[model samples]
Target: MIAFLKGRLVEKTPTDIIIECNGVGYQVHISLHSYSLIKDSESILVYTYLQIKEDAHTLYGFVEKLERELFKLLISVSGIGGNTARNMLSYVTPKDLMQAIASNDIKTIQSIKGIGLKTAQRVVIDLQEKVQKMYGLEDLSTSVYNTNAEEALSALEVLGFVRKATEKVVKKIVDQQPDATVEQIIKLALKSL
Candidate 1:
């Protein structure tokens, strides 16, 4: 039941961060969204969920309580696991996910590279009510779309979108179209890849 951690960040990468608290180092997996907000010499805090299995005791951290809650909700879905839960957070924020769920916007949810229509629908059906209660179903789409381009590019790499593939796609698309949306960038990226 580790609710949160406050510490000096000692290391940072796209997938994980190491925080040194009271002379102890805690390695925690993170989403790129959280990684962007973390910087050098700054104290940071993250809500955490610990999963203990026979072979592993893994700690997953989130920059926001909503993200942590969503992570819990994601993993609770049948056939979804921690990696997929984290992946969902990588591309979608708490607000956006909720809005999509509330509105039954399966297309938006399915647009993420790895998710399918059925999975998207299932996720929305399962979580819409809970999210509406929690956040009032505010419009999270624009914010999610804006922050997600950069974050999703990083996450794309994690999901096996090759670096060369991403670089070629993002650079060309962003260069030609400064105001391109995440979906547009991804579409162009598919062509590039």
Candidate 2:
């Protein structure tokens, strides 16, 4: 199996990249998270997972081993194919995904495009125990959001506020007052909206 590739990045896009190694260019699929991490680098080493089928051989590349590992675990769930797993990764960072699963936050999972309530529930039910065991409670502390900001964001989203807009306003408020509580953030965001 081709475990990894090290070469010049000949082409790059949000969904894929072409890595040229030893005069051969390999097309590698990637999630948005990987793209963001690797976009500025001219040369990179990407750990890969090769999926072989009768008709095609596909390679999915990751900037971090942890992301590849998460991808593997995501695809292992019933009804989640590689593309669907990639979509999920594109929607959220691996740390956030781990937190969502560990906390049984189905709303976060369901928010991703193409994911329904059943799939989100299945993802939590199937992977929550395993993710908590592997990553543990300590690892979740350093996630994408402060607990207050995250809770406020969730509440704002439920109230029909768009996430991008809500985030911008909430971030401004939090930046001005770093220690803002969830209620404070939500109250300020509501006014801004």
The number of the candidate with the highest TM-score is 2
lDDT of 2 by residue, 51-159 (tens): 8878899999999988998898999899998899999999999988987898677889999999999999999888987887887643223333467778999999999
Candidate 1 lDDT (Cα, whole model)?
A: 0.76
Output the worst ten-in-a-row residue range by lDDT, candidate 2.
137-146
Which lDDT tens digits does candidate 1 get at residues 1-193?
7889899988899889998889999999998777776676669898999978799988999888878888898887876788787877788776676667776678878987689988898888788777767765533323443364576587678768877668646755664676777777777777777
Off by over 4 Å in 2: 138-193
Residue 138's lDDT in candidate 2: 30
Model 2 accuracy (lDDT, Cα): 0.87
- List candidate 1 segments past 4 Å from native: 138-193
Candidate 1, pairs of clashing residues: none
The TM-score measured for candidate 2 stands at 0.71
Provide the overall lDDT of each model, using Cα atoms, as 2-decimal numbers. 0.76, 0.87
